[model samples]
Target: MIKRILLLITLILQFSFLHAGIVILNGLTHSYTVENGKVYKGKIAIENTGSQPQSIKLFLQDFSYTADGTTHYTALHSHKRSNGDWIKFNTNLVTLKGREKTEVFYEIAIPDHVKDPGSYWSVVIVEPVEDIKPSDNKPGVNITSVIRYAIQIITNYDTEKAKPDLKFESVKVEKEDGKRTARIAIANNGNLYCKPTASLEVYNRTTGAKVGTFSSLTMGLLPSTSKTFYIDISKVPPAQYKATIIATDEDENAFALNVELEVKND
Candidate 1:
């Protein structure tokens, strides 16, 4: 009887190893940005690179870091396992071919009541479940494999009440095809709606004479919300250029903000 039991155990381990094979090929969407009180569309794409067919499960969970730098994961979907904090949705399963790829899409909405502007990260995990047949005619084996991807979320607040206190938080300039392009972040701290309009003015810093002006279309800024604007500075010669951002509220109250940037010839 003891010999039979040992044989059964060995067979079970062997069968478990042979029955399931799973590998993760790719993960989609590394970063995402959404304005406060806006809806965001998120999707994850995964490919099965294993030899055997398998059923894959997906779930969303929150990862928290403690004061001592310890990390813990809490399930965000309530229907799978009852943990007090539930965000939404439940576990979903899909079958994949030996080398097939699939995509899963979900929507997330950020409430307008969010008070802070910052970054948030979340993970979407894909688990593969497989069944194994025992060689000794004992119970079958079940195997699970998982893959996870990190997502970054940025929230910007733009509302109607904050206009005059708008300021440029940061500006990044990059050259492509001999043209200078800039990505600018404008933040509003006052009360009122402000629309951003920018004009690139080149000046001889010491002479104070405007060399050229390149204006951009106006973009709306809700109170307390930060808006990102893109501008092209290639037209201005290789010199010091002052980007004048003019913000106008619904009532025609306007404010002028300026940032000095340099253009270098390639």
Candidate 2:
């Protein structure tokens, strides 16, 4: 019983560390339906939930997820599929009073020469200008940390949605420091980018009964790219198990892959 309690606590801690930024009220509604060679207008709100005044910087970035599901952002114009050049915001910097909210309006100017007519995206990074290290102070004397929220601006210009083809190549179970995890190799063979949600169910080999389950958060993958979707299985008891992986694509298509996994406790 004590082991189970400790295991639950550890899982809670693991999830808490994944949180960044003060608050992002807009969840998946960041998507916008736009048209080519036209101007699309949209508004977003950013609030200062803290007790004091806060400074916010709004900018665009082209983002991608790594094999381990870590988000990496590049300058908006640096990427080949960037829509950064088309985005124009009311203000890049804003100061808000305590418990105050402000709305930022933006315009997307779709160029007539847009060759790729599928899905184009940019991350609206809402960064708090708090606790930033001084640039002129020195090299390695002080530490700095910045917490920010990434609001995805997914836009579709084509009449038809770009299809995403995802393939589950394999699952590898590895143990280190008594922690067990499953690394799922995912491949995107389509012409558009996609972020697929995944769930894993573990079944005991001996009794054929369900032992545990884990789910992975969504991560975007560009076309013709491969990434590893990592799932945590450290809380699972030491036993021989088989995992059933269920991945549902953009168009509600489901794919299943089964892999054998063995867990050894610390």
Candidate 3:
């Protein structure tokens, strides 16, 4: 329950730190599929809603996601997970006039020698140009903060080896928003993407008899990323019960998690 509360708080904090004026309308993630050797092109719109012009710079970076659900980014030319090399953009810098919008075009080139099929990605980071100026009547240091937003570009090769792989990291039962909910965190440590169909079957603890079932929200999980889904069990009886959550994907991969939850009358 405490963990659930913390998760809710963290989500609130993330939204509070969003950009004040600039907006990326295409969202933060883009997925693409390229054959053996093909060129995939796309564009995204960036709008400056503020009254003043803003200078922005765009670039790509390599990133890694851990089991803790945090993302760590490295240089564009990192040793592994470096998709920035395959990408070329039409523009690297742009100045958006007040109430102006512009489209940035990008292309992903797949080499002919690339045969291994898997998922690769890079983060398209949009940030303001940093400025440094000497303060006349100030101390030794002047620190200015720059806020950057990352848009993930995921590429997948069309091959059978790019399959969906999922594993359960943890299962949690919590009371959230006056409802009994089961939260399951799963990690996709594979080369593909998947949307798992999640369901829960509640059983009587003493007799082990099947009592009721519940269904949760399902979403797409990308490669090297983790997603936590929730199942609402508000209608279950107020008794000690055992619930088995069964999640299946279009690839026929199944994951089951057993958790104990006690429904309340309040």
Better of 2 and 3 by TM-score: 3
Model 2 per-residue lDDT tens digits across residues 46-117: 777766777888888887664555667888766566777888899999888777788888988988887665
Between the candidate structures 1 and 3, which one is better when assessed by TM-score? 3
| TM-scores of the candidates in the order shown | 0.39, 0.69, 0.77
Residue clash pairs of candidate 3:
none
Least well predicted 10-residue stretch by lDDT in candidate 2: 16-25
Per-candidate local distance difference test: 0.56, 0.75, 0.78
Q: Comparing candidate 1 with candidate 2, which one achieves the higher TM-score?
A: 2
Which of the predicted structures, 2 or 3, would earn the higher lDDT when compared with the native? 3
Model 3 backbone overlap count: 0
Top of the candidates by lDDT: 3
**Candidate 2 pairs with clashing backbones:** none
The clash numbers for all candidates, in the given order, read 13, 0, 0
lDDT of 3 by residue, 1-266 (tens): 99999999999967644433588978888888778678999877898876676888998888766545687788986644467888898999999887889999999997787766777788899887744545688567655566678888888777477787778777766787778776778788777767787788989999999987777776777677787778887777677788787888867788787888666555
Error of 1 at 140 (Å): 12
Q: Which candidate is the best by TM-score?
A: 3
Q: What is the full ranking by TM-score, best candidate first?
A: 3, 2, 1
RMSD per candidate (Å) reads 14.3, 7.6, 7.0
